[model samples]
Target: MSRKRVAEPGPLSEHVPGRKKACWGILTSQGSWADRSPLHEAASQGRLLALRTLLAQGYHTNIVTIDHVSPLHEACLSGHVACVRALINAGANVNAATIDGATPLYNCCASGSAACMELLLQNGAHTHTTHAHFPSALHEACKRGYSQCVESLLSHGADPDYGVAHLGSALYMSCLHRHTECSRILLHSGAKVNVGRDSDSPLHAAVRQDSADQASVLLDYGADVYLRDSNNQRAVELAPPGGKTHQLLLTFEVAPRTLCQLCRLHIRTVIGPSRLKQLPVLPLPSLLTHYLEYT
Candidate 1:
């Protein structure tokens, strides 16, 4: 589990003053290992002993691969909590970005590891880091149906609407993937129910994916039923013909909201996303509080 620090002059011997040795020699030691360093491999495979030994032998924890992916990114992407802790403890840059601008926090969310996510956030990982493909950590969590990761990101103030431009909102992603739990969590956290890109609303995305459950959840959260997509089709029109999703949307479109429901929706809008969690402790009746909380 240990490696000798050979003092030979080679690719790893060109010492940048004040910098740890780059593990480029280790990367070229095997044909199968193309761009990854020894630290990246050990951290990626959860090889704690090897990872610890590499750090102990003065291998730079901040050394990045050709794509600018550090060992910390590998650790978080693989959900290797021990490796993540080792890298963080050894002064790995938690906010280091890949060539596409993805951070270790975004990788953790992609892997659906709340433990790694919490550790990264506690160690100063930026939740707002967006990549070319992913808009935010919250968007990654929603796309992959990681409800726990989504909740963790929300609690840490990850914006639910962070990626509206490229990937659409987190709610839209969750609905597109038919992740009812993630959609519920995002809605309860005050994600905009009707928010979408120019092409589709969350409801349209849900029905297009044929997710009746997600579409129902969106309706319950007061999503606008009559919203149109870029194709000028309503959500009900996009639903599968003679399918449950179509039926549900048709019912919602025909049935008018009760006065109490309208009042609850207005109250939620007035309180805004920040104060939505306070509805439970208000002086309202338990049933009313539950209603306001979208129980």
Candidate 2:
């Protein structure tokens, strides 16, 4: 996928006339990016009553600071759903980004605010980033081990394999940070097991973190143990010798697949990650569906 800069935002001229063009490296529209206001204070502090009063008094919902962070950003980051709802209802830009390229959706992920995530997505917040460099919303969720946010973003079309040059893939971040559930969710969602920053795979991340369980999960999902990083070191090379993770990877290298394990892996691969959600609804017997859900 092209990493082109997001398109320049249109102006918010109708909201306020004296403002300059929208900027977060360029354009969104006529909203005022003035110094912080009472509205910002109210939103960030979770003062819903104060926020409602300000909005009732005509505080522009899109008013931002010099960096272009709107009140919606503040509310979402703090997990203040009432404030978030109020701001969005008052016309806050659901997709407004900071100069650093943070959208309210990104903030919701960063804060692990799944409730705020639902509200924003319902308000039409863009899940896929328009910018090339900033971590996508999905990355933020996985990095923080926010499994609920990760699941929601995936359900909303967040790319499971979206990667940044420095952050690696979302799966890499999850395992490197020792987020077991997040890593499992990413793998089950069909994120490429071997995709990582440069040549490092998620298996490399799991081993580096000394997470035996994570490494085992990656192996189950077909992570390539022999994959090398920039240093030409395999995942086992990063492990402390004879440690649990090193031992686990070593075990995976030598163990023949159990027939049941092979069958499950084959079924998942054939069903494809994108289609895994269909398992519950398929006409398969309950016993089969229950077994499939184990992974």
Candidate 3:
């Protein structure tokens, strides 16, 4: 007896011609159709078989969507491990970026998907490349408080000092976002505690946030306690008045502003005519008050 050959089912007879067809799990025209391939959609839906078939059919592995997003980026963003694996196996560019330069790891980090991030890492997704919006995977993980993701990134040798948009590095983002644990990890992993931006230190950003704990953490990590900003205001000036941040600054022995001292001396010079004639006088509060009344 001859072996029988089984025929695969053809395209669904009810499928409308020239209308959108579901190929490899993506709703699009036929592979030979004139329009673009739906790689992003298939990758996004975790349609592993369709993705493999598309690749086998010589469809461009890096076909992008209307937004210029790649299939690998879609897989990472959607947390589709299988799709990601298939795309990687099919020679999809692991580090292929969208128009804005966001890699697969950036997408995984944005989603806080550690599994996806790990897969991307194992597959050589570039962790150092930043998008126009954000820099490294560590920055996104820190911003989102994803400690596991952060740790995975660190373990993979992702630098915690990666900076973006001239705002400074991953440690800078961690401090600005007040992710204490993540910041601590970054600090221990060689992130610069005093990574300065526009003359402000991590301590200054922490002070601006009014988080005494974060300030103390940065300080303990060697952040410059006396760093000032563009307005000539130091960390102490940024702290909320009468809060624990205020009480805590005294422990650091930071001197208050001398503007009040200069104001007192100038007032004494203007009002105390007799004292000015006698000699220079220290502008004690009592002497200043006496001059106010005498003048």
Candidate 4:
């Protein structure tokens, strides 16, 4: 988006003696006319003086773009700590979400801006709010391996088990983004290592994400090796072809048990077809819950 640059002058011109209006000349030069907010432009360009001036003159800190991206989102993206602080002090809603439901904290953390993240969190930002448009800030932090920021959000009650639009959980995101250390932290902090959401298990995420370290961590934390994704692919099948990570899964085996074909097939449908063959045969009993646990 483009914004009009107002000439540098004091706000609100007062009437002087009558003067003739100057005739305007259209420049055939390179530029085209633009339409956007002065405040938004200033914030986006990190023009601290203009931003501060606007804020001081009572320009709205809560101004947003057509897409509902906030000034805070711009400030965080521009790495303008001073502008961010000024906007927050000017009573900007620190937790304000964009049109996509991404909060300022989510933007800050996603951009790897630890200082901005701390400021947002200290100023009462919502670490637990999930974005229907995408993953939460904890997921962003974990995905990016922003360990310090991750710790900060976790301290402020960010849920390790939080799920979002495509990402299953913080653990899932960490795996997907290949942030091995962050995955380890979340798992140690009580993230469900074996759970799936939106039909994606951590094993599925790890293999698809090409994260050997994260996959190992998940296995150590009891990730189900035989778990499957929506595509009917096992974790082993998801692994990159010809690698130690692939070999590791090939070596790990679950003990065998006999199960009814219908129940087993139903479980396979829930999990995936590729995993069905790996499952041990189960015994016949009035099936209440057909799932089995190696532990």
Candidate 5:
């Protein structure tokens, strides 16, 4: 997507008058020039001053390009918090989606911007909005190892188990990418450790990454060690021979859990996924709370 600054000082000029028409260009697969807009340019470049000036001049905040991408989408995708705030305050639709169905919140996740994500959520961005053939915001955050973005989305009521079409859940994406912190935060947020059918489980994805740390986090959060994949192979069987992941899985298979670990798992199950966050302040000892939280 290319943004051509208007040469004359119109109500939506991005530069000083007569400043040589510098254009900020973004390479894209879509060759159609009809998708470009001045609002998009201002937001994509984090031009807060120009954006506000345009809004003050009565430019529509909800204007979209040919593909239906709004200025709010551009601002959030670029991680421009000030521009995002300005657009939202000017009545931009926080949940505006592109023609491909990518929402502004999804763009924020792709950018890994917790501030932009938070601002969009505060302005009523829908957490359940999913892109066509793409995952939810939480899934995008996990795939990119954006732990803060994951936390922000989760805190604002994003569903941890919201799976992508044919791509499994956020936990699976985190495990697939070997993002230990992202996996940990998802587990803490009560994501299913063994979600998906057969080979699509988070454990299976973790084994595919050959990451002992990521596998351990899943196992610690109560992932089933003996679950079979589509090929009837267990996660341990999928691990590379003599690898750290294989060694770690082998040990886990043989070692019995401590009484504390069993109690934590049981408590988590009883509390249900959404209520798991309340355990930290449920009159329990701080150490026990930390242990339950896997801190």
Candidate 6:
């Protein structure tokens, strides 16, 4: 990536005569965020040495552009762990939000930066945002199939099934995007298999996306095949004829649940999803432990 030339002092100075050509880097108005300071540039470009120099010179770490985006937000968005660490160490607010409700933590979630997420969480960045207008960090992580980020958010107390205004549950987003691993993580973390946007179940999303693997995972977690969506369509109705998903659904519909499968489900219910990780050490037979943990 070509680095943009830096204009001195402030963002407004870029409009000065004769500086127009050289200032093209930020000429786009810092990606339209507006009024970004030198700190934002250093952070966004991952210029760690220059950024540290700026911080040493007493530049404000928490300074915001017109959109209220801090240097930490810039660093997190770019997935620059060094710049993020420098900003946080210099007192940048980890929880600072843009005007549109994007926080530094949210940027980290979008970038799939698990290290940045852990650092932010340790600094008190909220795992769950009360921003009704924006997708939660968990939702972003799952939607992008950032499985590590998903696990980190879940470990930090993010609600697995918290629905956004229009994005539905994190499980639904994962299933809709065909991210089977994310969907599995959500299910194992106690996300309700059937609760989704309005009426579209995770199974419906899986079927619509034609992800037979996701459909199988959701079924194992007890997703209902006969559930109706906003359009009153069941999962089978959404599956393409003769598709992998269609075949799987038809087979499932034809056969009853196996005794072993029911036993596994019942055992998982008794153990609880939160404590499933403890199954390996329960002093039971290895086969039984594997069955419970689905190892």
TM-score of every candidate relative to the true structure: 0.86, 0.86, 0.68, 0.67, 0.86, 0.84
lDDT of 2 by residue, 1-295 (tens): 1112334456456767566564343223554444566787899899999999989987778877767777888898889999998888888899888878889999998889999999989879888787778658888888889999999988887788888877989999998899999988888787888888888788888888899999888888777777888899999889999899888877878985689987987787788877877899999999998777663
lDDT of 2 at 208: 86
Give candidates' CA RMSD values in order.
6.1, 6.9, 18.3, 11.5, 7.2, 5.9
Q: Best by lDDT, which number?
A: 2
lDDT of each: 0.81, 0.83, 0.69, 0.68, 0.81, 0.81
Error of 2 at 132 (Å): 2.0
lDDT tens readout by residue for model 5, 83-130: 999898889898877766778898988888899999988878889764
Model 3: residues with Cα > 4 Å off, grouped in runs? 1-37, 49-58, 130-134, 254-295
Runs off by more than 4 Å, candidate 2: 1-32
TM-score of 5: 0.86
lDDT string, candidate 4, 1-295, tens digits: 1212334333333465542222111111422222235676787788989999988886667766546666777887666788888889888898777656777787777678888888888899988764355547887788788988787877677776777756677777777778888877766555677775676788888787777777777776667777667887789997788887787777665432234433533443454423333344544342423342211
Better of 2 and 4 by lDDT: 2
Model 3, position 104, has a per-residue lDDT of 82
**Could you tell which candidate, 2 or 4, scores higher by TM-score?**
2
Local accuracy of candidate 6 as per-residue lDDT tens digits, 83-140: 8888888888888877778888888878999998988988889887776876478888
Quick one: ranking by lDDT, best first?
2, 1, 6, 5, 3, 4
lDDT per residue, candidate 3, 195-215, as tens digits?
756577788777777778887
Q: lDDT at 8 for candidate 5? A: 33
Global local distance difference test of model 5: 0.81
Q: Model 1, which residues run further than 4 Å from truth?
A: 1-34, 130-135, 281-284
